[model samples]
Target chain A: MTLVESLSTGTGFWNPLAWLIAVLVAAVIVYLIRQRGESGYKKGTTQTVPFISGNPEPEKEMVHVRASNLYWGYLDALKGYYNFIVPAHTGVLNDYVLWYLGTTAALFVVVVFI
Target chain B: MFWNLPFIAVVALSLIGLATIVIKKNLIKIFLGITIFESAVNLFLISLGYRAGGIAPIFTSAPSTDMVLATPQALTLTSIVIGVATSALLLSFAVIIWKKYGTINTDEIRRLRE
Candidate 1:
């Protein structure tokens, strides 16, 4: 009812006013931290180039990250789960349909019986 | 329950349509499923207007005035028109996708495909 109070969503509440204040506070904190960033590195020099784990940097042309490699760490951490899930995504059309129907039937059974 | 057979058919058709969309990889099949879903909706609208032994909503019938509601029929007509447009657009997109990708499998259309 009030501007500062959360609006009830029946299952949850959201307060735009509170979120706005939080965002403003976070922005101020970020600005302060940015002010502390070291400007010791010379611009338009070798110092501007990215350091590769204390090794010589590769060619600037090959500096880009591949799309699949972007999530390498996350995928490695969840390798066990991904092992089952990723292989299950066989490019075959029929298998995907089977999965969809299987999930729907399972949910229907659960909803009806439980 | 026998009297509500059309309503049951509507539910079944809707579920089938949804299953087709989720399970099928062929873009054309997905469009067909969309059409089926739209038909199910149209069937639902038509069924909702039905009265026991009711004749068509033509006032000029000269029979008893116990006729099915006409508003839902009009709504069904509008729905069919929209469905036709949607199917056309969907098929056109499917054609374009096939031409560009050379395959219709959804798995092959993945963004991270190396």
Candidate 2:
């Protein structure tokens, strides 16, 4: 069979070529939109800072919030649902593995029983 | 048509994701790139199960399984839900970063420990 015939005859919905074309079109559109030129900045020549009459610059101090404190706030807001919350992301490899495994199992069950 | 949809979707998604990562400076936008890739993979998986004449897998007074493939639909749902969760978590991280640094640009968020 000719290549054209092969391409046209097997026009099933599950065609890989069609998927590829769709992906290509989407990607190209995104790229094109992103590449569009930005409008010129319209900033005034005067670069004077905003005046806070009489008020000082609040000590120019850096406020550092501890990770632990942040975690506490999040946990408190979540209440009991996500009790095992932590102060910082551990980036733990094991945790990721466990999460993926659990999700896979859940999906499997859902698909089978759905 | 059906068989090619996923392939095209994946390619398109990959391109979009890559463009997002390349062009966006905001941490949140970068995270969006990852999520875009995730969506593309999910679409590919769903496309994998597409059948020209398969019927929906619903049990209620439904048509025969002549034009539906239940596996892809179920998997797509699972992936979409997971995507939502991941997006929420990423957004939370973005918020925290904004609070800490008062900016979302990756270049400016260098104060925190790697």
Question: Which is the leading candidate under lDDT?
Answer: 1
Model 2, C-alpha of A17: deviation from truth (Å): 66
| TM-score per candidate for chain A alone | 0.50, 0.30
User: Candidate 1 regions off by >4 Å?
Assistant: A1-77, A87-101, B1-26, B60-66, B105-114
Give the alpha carbon lDDT tens digit for every residue of A1-114 in model 1: 465788899999999988999999999999999999987867799787777778987886688877977888898999999888887767655566678778989999999999
Worst lDDT run of 10 residues, candidate 2 chain A, spans A87-96
Question: Model-by-model lDDT, in order?
Answer: 0.84, 0.71
Residue pairs in steric clash, candidate 1? A97-B23
Give me the displacement of residue A44 in model 1, in angstroms: 14
* Candidate 1 residue lDDT tens string, B1-114: 887999999999999998888878777887788899999999999988877777888888649887777899899999999999999988888788789889877767664421
- Single out the weakest 10-residue window by summed lDDT for candidate 1 chain B: B105-114
Over A14-113, each residue of candidate 2 has an lDDT whose tens digit, in order, gives 5566677889999999999988979555677433444568555354444466566677876677876654444223343234434665787799999999
Report the Cα lDDT for residue A52, model 1.
78
Q: Each candidate's DockQ score against the native complex?
A: 0.18, 0.02
